[model samples]
Target chain A: MKIIVCVKRVVDTETRVKVAADGRSIDLGGVQFIMAPYDEMAVEKAIQLRDAAGTGSVTVVTVGPAAATKELRTALAMGADDAVHAVVEARMGPNATAEALKQVIDGREYDLILCGKQATDEDDAAVGPLLAAALGLPCVAFVHGLTVDGRTAIAEREVDGETERLDVDLPAVITAQKGLAEARYPGLKGIMAAKKKPLETVACDATGGKTELRSLELPPARAAMVKIEPTAAGMQSLLTALRNDKKVL
Target chain B: MAKYEAPDFFDLDSLLTEEERMVRDAVRDWVSDRFMPVVEKAYSEGYFPKDLIPELAELGVLGGNLDYADFPRLGPVAYGLVMQELERGDSGLRSFVSVQGALVMFPIWRYGSDEQKARWLPALHSGEAVGCFGLTEPDHGSDPGGMETKAVRDGDGFVLNGAKMWITNGNMAQVAVVWAKLDGVIHGFVVPTDAPGFTVREQRGKHSLRASVTSELIFQDVRLPASAILPGAKGLGGPLSCLNQARYGIAWGVVGAAMAVYDEVRQYGLTRIQFGKPIASFQLYQAKLVESLTEITKAQLMNLRMGRLKEAGGVTPYHVSMAKRNACHHALEIARTGRDMLGANGVAGEYQTMRHMCNLESVKTYEGTHDIHTLILGRQITGLDAFGAA
Candidate 1:
């Protein structure tokens, strides 16, 4: 089955960022970009399925400015069969990004569409279901266990703290989580081979959306952390502090 | 054959964290199922298992040591474990990957020109291009400064002449990184194995390291263009650094051999009945088995710390020298002791101790001789230049 996994180019999780002058925009200057952590897990899961089956092709799709190609190449390096980069000439958020990806994936039929439940930085988990609704396909939201047989995908997703099993139809959309699979590192050979693999970029028409903000803003700073001691009296003191000064009780 | 209990926490099947444990177990599985069965037949029969190299490459087991935190793996300790398992099957099998990953691919990744790195590393990493390091000459083994491999200035290129002794994988190597004394300076030459005037003859009738493809290399009037020279390398330090890098790997590798041998003895002592009871019931057998565990643990911890220190940018030649000496010394002793526990069968080809014992004799002697490391450590502990201008 042919599949397209949507990956986002984001700051590496290890990066510590200072908020930009504008509230909603992040200060990105000189920061290193990597495939989003959860997205890498999704990519690994897709590639693992494709490799294990030994018959299907996996195409990685990313939409952003010119710099988005780096994420596509990284996915290719991690063993994606090919890539389709929806080049956005203008700035785009999740809605536009999903729209652009849907447009690119529209002309071609995909067995399944995989994405992360949420981008770590943004915490928006709407993309998979959004794309599923747009494509008019069944949505497999927050899927943690996935396996393919013939054309159907057998998967389980957590609902109300209990896992609900489902046999999703082909051409469905699923968001992957950490439990899906441990990610694979790009070996030296794969990194070299990635350079030769096919990456096709097509111009994406802007199908804009309605969530407009007058200004970008940053959240308030996190409270400073204080060390806690482990002795009995120290532990009692810590409990009192948590109930009193910290107000965590 | 003795039953194996948990193999002293270095079995790798037990040593790594769960995720990393899976990776290590995968390596052993591949080694056992794919490489091990084919190795002895190839080595004793004097053939190189050229096909298996790519298999190793595919698993990223070849130079899989390059650090990346996102996909954490068993590092130097596991690397040592993998190499040891392969070498336990046969030194030739281990050397094929080692020479490619540790000796050749490592240098290209670290010191080659951009185009060279882009060109050679991927091919070697994938097992398409086989590489052999040419540093030891007929005259020089440990002290490569005494090397007489000559590279004379000729236009934009150089002509090389000199013979190399005991080159592992030399016959089957498609490309060789030959170290030569250029003018009065030392330089590394990436000579094609099929380069004009470069010839290799496999040394025959070997009692030790018989599983490996070892050869005496002759480079008579061999010419290489200036582009063939490693651009980022200079001086005797260039090749010595490579040897130091390789020796660190060997130090870790020998510990693995020692562990396997020790494990064999431990199992043999428990099963082989003598005096109408198991030999392991004897105080003497227990002593040998316990000693093997103790020393192997020390070496395992040492190599693990060495790997951490290396990743932290804290490695020195002295640390590796100390490790190499201790591990090789203990390995040789362990092999001999393990062989005794097996009695007549140890010397027989049915078991692995005597073969390991024989192969380790060569391993201990190469990279840096055990005695040479003793002096290198002596120089470190005491401010003495023993192997100095005399």
Candidate 2:
């Protein structure tokens, strides 16, 4: 199987994100950026399938400024054969990201394409399905586990309290989840080798904004964690607040 | 439909420079992807993951923490944050690095001979070889000074005789930093565990720190060349310094463990039902969760400041004592509360809280007992001698 895993460089999950003063994007001031969490799972799943299947090239593609190369190289160091960094503006919306990734994967024959269900920073989660749509392939979301056999793919998904199983064709898109597999760490030799790996830089065909952000707005302030007694009285008091103050009880 | 929000709300912009943020985030991503998923499993199985050491080395987490580079951190906070996040998965795995980076690697870097360092550091840092610290003997828990372990200077080398207990990563170690009294002066040595007379007996049936391999090291007159003595190190201060580094990291580490247990319990409380409603509706559950968050917050703040102090070179044992003690205690409490809130299921190894709760029991005792920090603070406040506190 020829698999292409799409990853994104986003704000660190633990970072204290603030809205940009312009009210159209997250403030880069204090935010620490990192590889999106689910993308990592996607990368791991792709690698696992490649290894278990005993054949295939795992290519990681990321869309961002030059800094995105680091996460791309990291994927390379973790056993990916090569990488493509599609440079795009940081303020690019989900469509821009998907379009940029699209250009990178275009005309490249691939049997399977993998992606994180969503990026933690934008949390739009549209990039995977969008890329699949742009490429015109089958798509599955919130997949907890995945496997590939010949021209078919198998996936496990969580629903309500029970887990569901899914099947799709080889030329499909899968959004990875938590239990797929644990990602492996790169050894020092790999870390050293990643610096010298063949990372190809490509231009994105974003073709401008598919969706324009008029402005970026900061989320409303969270109410301080006030003590709420978990009792009838406390429940009633909360209910009263909804009924009397915030309305819609 | 729901939208996700970020967890960072700290007004710490003024506190950190841009470069520090880059280094911190890079390390965070590395650990989250590499360590988090398998950590709970490693901890529950009571096995130190041999594979991840090199991965950590590749991320530069082992000794890159204390060294200077393009990132001139104002505090050891970067290092602290790394440990904190590692422990968020499980403490035993973090302790493995603690034993190497802080315990074994630091000493060799600080005190090893040029030859010794050249021979050992690169491999240890690369995680090619597992390293551990053996300061606590069966009889030398808190009073390492009264250690019965002895090293007699032989013809061209020294012969070591002793048994060390509760050594983290011990049974699996390729190397160990050992302290033994020599000619009335306590000194440290870098002993290869596979040396002729050296034997590492894995401690069995442990209820705590099951993920980390605990062992009793029996050096039955282990003999090695004089080169084994760390040239720059002599006396208790050497081992103590290594312990301080580990403890500083531990102070940050336990907070992560505390956060995990608290998060689990809070989630459980919010969803679990009692009396025909969510038990989170109870004031008692709220109190438990609130107090947990309160402690976690305080510990986080303490560690953040402590990191800066460490980077600023103003960090002393007392500085580390404060954070380590608080974090250890809170982590233990949080784990216990987590188990309690979950009722019988908490005791099972399925959830991470029970394992961490059990592990913290050992973490609390090692590096320095919780009571040791109380008295270290006491000594700072009042000029009183308290060997009795030991």
Candidate 3:
């Protein structure tokens, strides 16, 4: 089985985000970037399936500027066989990004494709479905568990507090969820070996996203927490406040 | 807590190779993710988290810079970066790797016979077997050439006798690279810890480097096969060479400790309120932060230069001693300053400043004492040996 895992580079989840001066994007100064968390799960799952099959390759593809190669190197260090750098200089939306990935995967030989349910930065959650639609392949979203047997792939997802199992034929796309697979830390050996791995950079012309981002703003600041006493009179006062002042009783 | 941003006041990252930065980042992340959560508890409980051995081996840190099969032959700078990152988490963690890679595995690779290498290198690399360097005897630390550990030729084998003290990984080691005198000359011997007459005693009640294992090793007429001797090791230079390797690592390792403490205190000062504002706004605190950052930056440059010189093969033991001495002193002082900067919170277990301060005490004293390195450099500069007098 040949697999292609799509990844995105986004600001680390722990970063203290600041809106850029442009008012439509985030400030990148001093910001650290990581392969999107869920996308790590996708890369891990691809490596796992390839290993279990004992004979296959995992090709990680990403659409971003040259700096995104750091994330690509991270994926390769996590055991991807090779990587493809679809060099898209500008920041594009999900539709355009998906279109670039599709252009890259147009003639690739892959039995499966994997992507995170969404990139954490924008959280669009639209790339996987969009790519699958473009390729006319079956797409399963929010997959937590997956297994491949012969020509069939079984995926498990949580829907409405219920477990839903879907069976898809070969050559499908799956969006990885939290429980899909746990990413491994790139070992020193892997980091060194990744330098020697095959990474082909291709200039991509895919641009002009379907949607444009509007002015962004930070959320309103939260109020300081209020401490409540445990005494009976305090409890009565709290009830009064909740019912009268806060009106949440 | 604010995410740790390593002090790169000098932009040292620009001086490092891409691979060096990548390897350093990988180790840093592993320490942040797997080691940090358990470090405080491990230190308080006085145990070196043995569970991390497999992970360390899997990461290929054990004997990583060696020519052993499948091991990455990382350059001196890369290896030093690994030490720096590990020590940033805790000195004990870095000590574990330094002893394994530089002290124990290095000798076996550099001097042991083919059989010895085939037998122990892979096991040590995989961390299936633990090893310790046994040169600092109870009576001979700085002057290991005066060691009393002796080996007598006994019919196609040797009988070893003596005790080694302050042995890191001693109690847990399956093998020890023991330096002993034979025919009035020093030689390196690979002794199995499980051999009859060989004994290990744990040293308890350590206030410094509490997260690491320190023990005493005793060899009472321990019989060893003729093959146990490292074939290429003839004199004190063999063990001294190993010390040089570890000291080189130490020079880089303490910078990590310094960076960790500096980062912690800088973050603390920025948010810590005093006199109606962040203490960082005060001149006193700013001076402290600047002093610490300045020293750390100097140490980083020195370490990188030393590493490059080592890789170029022009580095002498004197250079190694100077780097080790200066870096250790600066880092220890930085840790103490950081601890003091934290004030009451410094002594609290939640913060890492005090832990680093305590661990650095051991780091400064080990390999070569700060004073010993001073004398070594002093002797080199003045062409006079002040180590002894008539």
Candidate 4:
């Protein structure tokens, strides 16, 4: 099972993000970049499938600037065989990113294409389906559990609080959810080995898609809490305040 | 409470290679996620968290530098970073790795016969077999050469008799690399823990390194085969070389402990209110923080240079001694300052300052005391042995 996992390098979720002086984008300074959490699940799942087959390759593909190779190398360190960086100088939307990934993955004889359900940065869940459509393959989204046997793939996805099992044929795209598998920490040996693994970079000329970013701003601060005593008079006052001041009863 | 943040004041991450950063980040994540949650409880309970051994092995931290075919052969700097990250959690955790990797597996790899290496290295690497280095006896701490543990030549094997004290992982180890006198010359012996007449007793009531398992090993006429002796080791040079390896790791490990305390106190100062504002607003606290950061940065640079030299095979015992001494001394001071900065909260384990401060006391004393290292440097510069005489 030759698997290709699409990953992205995004600012760590834990980072305290600040808007750049330019109103259109976030400040990159002092921000730590890590593999997108959902993409980590995808990469881990690909590696697991490859390992279980006992003979196959797991190649991680990312679309970003040269610095994105750090995330690619990290994926490789998680036991992927190689990596492909579709180099994009500017931030690209889901369609352009998917187009770049399709270009990089062209001519690769991959049996399975995996991607995160959504990138945390934008939460744009369109790339997997877009890429799969462009490549003319069936797509499975929000895959929490997946198993492949011969040319058929069985995937379990949670839909409306119920698990929906789907059987997809070979050459399918799957977008992994959180519970795909617990991502393993890259061992020291794997880190050292990742340096020696092949990482190929292809320049991508990504035209802007239909989406445009007008501006970025911090969310409004939360309202302060209202405290009331435990006495009946305090409770009556709190109820009156909630009904009149906040307009919620 | 604020989350614990690691302080990397100098952007030292850029100094490391990509692979080095990955290794460090992985260890840092593991330590923060797994070790931090349980360390205080483990320390208070006074027992090593043995459940973490498998995870440590999976991370390839055990014997990480040794070139076992199945194990990760990380660079010296990477290995040092592992020690640093582990010590960031606690010194006892770091000591466990140091004893296993440098003291036990290193000797077996460098001195043991091919057969012996094949028998022990893989098991030790996988954490299936825990091992300890037995050199420090009850009477002998700094001067291991005067160890009374002796092995006499018998028909085919040697009869070993002696007591080793303050052995880390002593009670938990399945095997031990013991340094004993053979015909008045120090030699290394691989002794199984379950060998007849060999008894291990846990040393209880330790305020320092309480999370670690320190025990006493007594060999009462224990007989071992000739093949059990490390073939490539002879005289005091053998154990001393192993100590050098461990000491080099200690040099790096203490920096992590210092960083932990420095980070904890720095956070505490920022949020801790006193006299109308955070204590961090005070000049006294600022001065202490500056001092600690300065010392930690210096130690980081020293260890980086030492690591490179060691990787290049240009490092000498004197270099290791200087680094170990400097790092330990500065770490102790940083821990103390950090403790003081926390004020009354410093005495509590919840703050983590007191734990690091207590752990450094043992770190300073072990792997050659700070004074012993000073004499080592003193001898190197002055060409005079100030160790024994006035």
Candidate 5:
């Protein structure tokens, strides 16, 4: 069982993002980058599957600039057998990123492709499905639990207020959800071994996509709260304000 | 529910390699999750969390730098960062690793015969067998050459009689690296704790580093085979070299303790209001924070350069002495100031500042005292023997 896990490098969620001077993107200066949180789940799941089977390889791939190798190395440190970096000088949309990934995976004999349900920065849950369509393979989205046996795989996905279980065959793409697996911290041995592991980089040709960014701006600041007493008179005033002004009472 | 935000004012993260960062993150996460939850309680209760030893071993922190065939070899910088992260959780935790790695396993790796190495290194690395270095005796702390422990050859074995004081992990260790005089010359012996006439007594009522195990080891007519002596070491140079290794780790470990305290106080000052405004707005509080940050940054650079030198070889004891003295002194001062910034809350163990403050007191005194290191540096520069008579 050969598995390919797709990861992304994103600004740490703890960071306070600022709009770039161009008004169309985020400022990258002094920002700390980390492996996308959700993608960590995908990488962890791939490693776990390989470990449980006792005979398989887990390969991690990322689509970004050359600096993205840091995230790839992090995955490798977490027990990925090898890594591939599809180098793109500039940021690309989900479709273009998927196409780059398609090029990287074209010649690989992979039984499974794992990815995060959505990238934290973009929040567009389209890459996995798009890549699956491009590769002509079935896709299981938002997988929370998964088990594989022979050529068949069983996955548990969380739908809108419901749990859906699906049976997908081999050569499938699975997008990991938050509950899929808890990512393991790489031990000292793994960190040392990762330095010697195989990491290949391939330059990707980005064919422009349909989506275009218009502008990026910070959200409006929230108004300060108006404290109200629990007394009947205070409650009556609050109700009157909500009914007349806010119109939600 | 306090969060840990590592202080990297100088963009120091850029100086570390990806592998180093991974190792740091792993140890940092483990310390936060496993050590932090119970550290205050353990300190207050005056008990070491022995349960975490297996997990710590699983993380490969014990003898982390030793090139054991079973474990991947980590560079000196990565190993130093591991010590830093452990100290961030608590100084006692860091001391445990320092004593186990630098003082115990390091001597065996550098001085033990092949058979001795094959017998002890693997078990020590796995934490299956705890080991302690016995050099600081009851009468000798700074001057180990004055130790009275004696080992006399008797046919195929040696009979040892002596006592070691302030020995970390002494009571819990299964094996001890005991330094004793053999034929009027100091030598190291691998003495098992369970040997005949061997006794260990735990030191009680410690105000500093209370979370660690401190004990006294006594060896009365304890016999060991001829092979027990470390063949590669002779006279006082053997144990002194081990102390040097431990001191290098101490230099890096104190920085972690200082960072933890500085981070805590900075957050407390910003949120703690006095006279209707946060104290951080005042110049007095800012001065303390600035001093701590400056000292921590300087210590960090010193440790990084020292780590590189150690890895490249040709690192002298005086070089380690400077770093150890500087880092420990600054860390003690930072912890005290951090405690002061906490006001009444500083006295509370719940805040973690006072605990670190007390722990830093032990760190400043152990491995090598701040004054001792200063004299070492002073002698290195002045070419004077001020240590014996001044």
Candidate 6:
């Protein structure tokens, strides 16, 4: 089965983020970027499915600025057959991003399309459902496990702290959850081969979407710890403080 | 915990190719995620992290630079980068890869017969069969040309008898690339560890490179067929060539150690308060950090150029000796400065600066000692053998 995985590049989770001078964006100076963690799982799952079939290709597509090619190349290094880089502005919303992906993926022959449940940077969780809706195909969100037999695909999704198994026909969309698959580090051979793999760069005009940003700020600092004595009256005082001062008794 | 910030004052990443950067990053991430967590335990307990062999093989680190059918052959620069990242985690880890690739698999690929290559290369590449190089003997180290190991011609095979000391992976090796004198001339022999009369003893209580395995190998009347001998290696040149390959990697590897120490001390100094301010505010501490960074940057450039030249088949043994000598000397000094900069906290295991400082002592002595390399370069430059007067 042929598979296509959609990925996004975001600031590395380990980096200390700073709000930009303009309150609407994040500061990009001297920050490192990586493929979103869940998206890595999606790419890994696509590769596994392609390899298990023994006669198929896995292609990764992304819509971002020119620098997104790094993440696309990383997907190729992780054993993806090829990559599609849709060069556009980095601030594209979910709808416009899905439209750009659809424009490129429309001409491809694929039995499955996978995406991360959400981008770690934005935490929008909208791109997969939006893309599936626009393509008019069945979608399984938060897929934890998946298998394919002939024309039908079975996906195990996480819902309300429980697993829900769903079987869908071929040519369906799936958004990978945390446990979908563990990504593998790229071997040196794969890294060398990735450079020779086909990477087709296309100019995309899909820019604006319905969502708009207002402002961004850091979370409030945590309150300092308050120590209480171990005596009965101290316990009573603690309870009184919890009920009276904090109002959470 | 904060992420490791590799010191790159010279913007060396800009000079690297995409493949080089990706390869380095892959190993760096692996070291951070897997190796760093276990390094202290392994070092304190004095055991090599043998379980990581399969993972390293999966990452294509073993035999990574050889040109076998399935091997990566990632070129010298990429291989050097792999060494750099591994050494950044710990010297013992890098030593394992060096011994496996440059010393063991390389000789088999370059000199062994087709049958021998087909037999051991795949196994070693996959980490199914661990291999060790047996050339440093009890009586011979700096001058391996005078090795006393004998391979007496007997029937259709040969009977070997000798002892090799300071053998890395000796206790765990399934095969050994042994160099012995055949009719008073050096020849390479591939000996299986399970052969009769072959014995291995692990050395204990080492203060340096404690996370690595070091053993003494004894061979008493061990017999091998004629096919066991490497067909192409005829003299000391064979083993010396392998040392050159390893030294090229060492030149790059030690820079990683220096960078690690430098980065650690720099971070610590910035936050550590002394005299009502961060200790980094002092000019004396700044001098140490500045010197460390400068030497590491120079070492990085030297190794990168050496790797490129090696890829182009233009690197000489003299050049490798120079790079190895210079890099090791400066790295050791930097580790010392970093250890002292931490003051009372330097000796604690919580900070890896002292661990790196101890490991560099062995790195300075192995492959080729800093002084030996200096003599080799001295002889090359002046066309005079420094040892001839003796």
Best by lDDT: 3
Instruction: Decide which is better by TM-score, 1 or 2.
Output: 2
Docking quality tier of candidate 6?
Answer: medium
Q: Write the per-residue lDDT of candidate 2 for residues B127-206, one digit (tens) a residue.
A: 78888888898877878888988999999999999888888888878999998889978888999988988888898888
Please write out the lDDT profile of model 4 over residues B259-338, one tens digit for every residue.
98998888888888999899999999999999999999999999999999989999999999999999999999999988
Q: Which regions of candidate 3 deviate over 4 angstroms?
A: A226-249, B388-390
Off by over 4 Å in 4: A232-240, B1-4
Per-residue lDDT of model 2, residues A163-217, tens digit only: 8887898799899877876776553334445666788988877665678878766
Candidate 5 Cα outliers beyond 4 Å, as residue runs: A159-163, A229-249
Please report how far candidate 4 places residue B68 from its true position, in Å: 2.7
Instruction: State which docking tier applies to candidate 1.
Output: incorrect
Q: How much of the real interface does each model capture, measured as fnat?
A: 0.03, 0.06, 0.69, 0.78, 0.78, 0.75
Compared with the true structure, model 6 gives a TM-score of 0.95
State the C-alpha lDDT per candidate.
0.76, 0.78, 0.93, 0.92, 0.90, 0.92
Instruction: Give the TM-score of chain A in candidate 6.
Output: 0.94
Candidate 5, B1-390: lDDT as tens digits: 566888888988899987888889889989987899999999999988999998888888999898878675788889889989999999999999999989999999999999989999989888898899899988899888889999999999899998999999988899999999999999989888999999999998999998999999998899899999999999989999999989888999999999999999998888988999999999999999999999999999999899889889978999999999999999999999899999999999889888988999989998889888888888889998679744
lDDT over C-alpha atoms for residue A172 of model 4? 95
lDDT of 6 by residue, B1-99 (tens): 357999887888888888899999999999999999999999989999999999999999998999998787888899999999999999999999899
Best by DockQ: 4
lDDT of 1 by residue, A133-236 (tens): 88899988778899998878999878899988999789789999779877765543454456678989898776665465456555687999878778898899
Write out the backbone clash pairs for model 1. Answer: A23-A216, A23-A217, A24-A216, A24-A217
Q: For residues A1-249, could you state the per-residue lDDT of candidate 5 as single tens digits?
A: 799999999988777899999999899987878888889999999999999999889999998988888888889888999999988868788999888899999999899999999989989999999999999999999999999988989999877879998999989999999999988777787788889899998877677465878899999999998888999989998999999989997
True contacts kept of 1: 0.03
**Order the candidates by lDDT, highest first — what do you get?**
3, 4, 6, 5, 2, 1
Tens-digit lDDT track for model 1 on B23-118? 444455466567656755664566777777767777776666653222223356556656655655566567667787777866766678777777
Stretch of 10 with least lDDT, candidate 4 chain B: B1-10
Which residue runs of candidate 2 sit more than 4 Å off their true CA positions?
A: A1-249, B1-45, B66-75, B388-390
